[model samples]
Target: MRDLLPPGVHVAESFGDPPGAVLLPEEEPAVARAVDRRRREYTTVRHLARRALRCLGHGAAALPPGEDRAPRWPTGVVGALTHCDGYRAAAVADATVVASVGIDAEPHEALPEEALGGVALPEEREHLARLDAAHPEFRWDRLLFSAKESVYKAWYPVTGAWLGFEQAVLTFDPAGSFRARVLPEAVVPGGPVVFDGRWCVTRSFVTTAVVVTRPDAAPPAPCGCPAR
Candidate 1:
């Protein structure tokens, strides 16, 4: 179950049926480098991620190097990381016990509706258009930008295929966690891929999303998978 941390302050979500707890550190500056915005941003998010890790009984020094480009935790761990203006956070779950998990956060921003053209599929654009129409002031583009990012981080580890923002379509339930469907014929691993997600924006400037997928359901001993 997801616990609301603060009223009108933010939102958080978890995936894949983990029985463990999720920690959402209230946002605050962690580094004293007022001179370097980038450094301060890194420090803030690192602090949030560290707190999340600690909740799992792991210390900051115990975390391993992240994946080459995807949102990956050290070997033997499954997780995702993300940060937005004034906020940095992470979500982790034992892969052996919970598959893959992803989390994302982004500050509200105005985006050209046209900018979404190349990033979102035709149907996706149509769906979001309806959303934008309903809520004329909604920052749908930024929301998609964040949601797609969360999906990429979650899917990358399993498919081992980098999904372009344009390759997948995200359909949001607007007031609820959205849905993302990989375009048919899209490149995916040669097996079952479980894709399920949820999202919420408890405040006007921030949006948070989570996607948890289980290991692909495999066939009998030997259809065609190469034995590792």
Candidate 2:
């Protein structure tokens, strides 16, 4: 999984844990209105984020939520976190060396058919159709959805602007990777940037990530399977 990320980004991960009774001092208030399961998932991922931060030479500190509800990392750090069912993970990077990152994980199962209408663009659907024709085994539609998610994650921090699924065009390859181009209409920093990302299918889940260090750096090559 680390190989798929760009330089400077570090990841931390953990399996499911039963809901605990206490929240770290900084995490308590944010979860005051959350239900038990949401609270448990939130704490577990933050815990993973802290561990990853430490690995990057950062001290453990409360990661608060920003107005848009994204994690507010300590000054000089940019990162993202994700969790699904039994898994949880976090990735962090120095702000100086890397601009932003976005990571996501989903069950290997196919995305529900009905939701595709909202998750895919007409061009993306055509792209998925081609992927489906060429490689019938994997769920290309779901993979496209995941790719868009990673694109959005990396994008929001850079611009703090909303990017609908239709606003970006995504294409995938046979090697478990993807590329995303933001439409010109979207007000991204320094204009639209192409994002190259890697994805892998493990025994339990499909994970994807996008790492951005410079607005003009060339996109990295796609990486292969079993991420995590």
Best by TM-score: 2
TM-scores, all candidates, are 0.70, 0.88
Q: Which parts of model 2 have CA positions greater than 4 angstroms off?
A: 18-22, 187-189, 215-228
The lDDT, on a scale of 0 to 1, for candidate 1 is 0.54
lDDT (10s digit) by residue, model 1, range 1-228: 123111111222322222232222322232233465554444444444454555444434233234473433545556666655555565554455445555677667765667776677778778878999998666787778877877777677667677788867777776666767776666665622335566666555445445453446332121121100
Off by over 4 Å in 1: 1-35, 62-67, 70-72, 190-194, 213-228
Residue by residue across 33-147, what tens digits does model 2's lDDT show? 9997888889888877777778556646788788888988888889998888888888887787678898988877789888899999888889889889998878787778777
Candidate 1 lDDT score at position 113 = 63
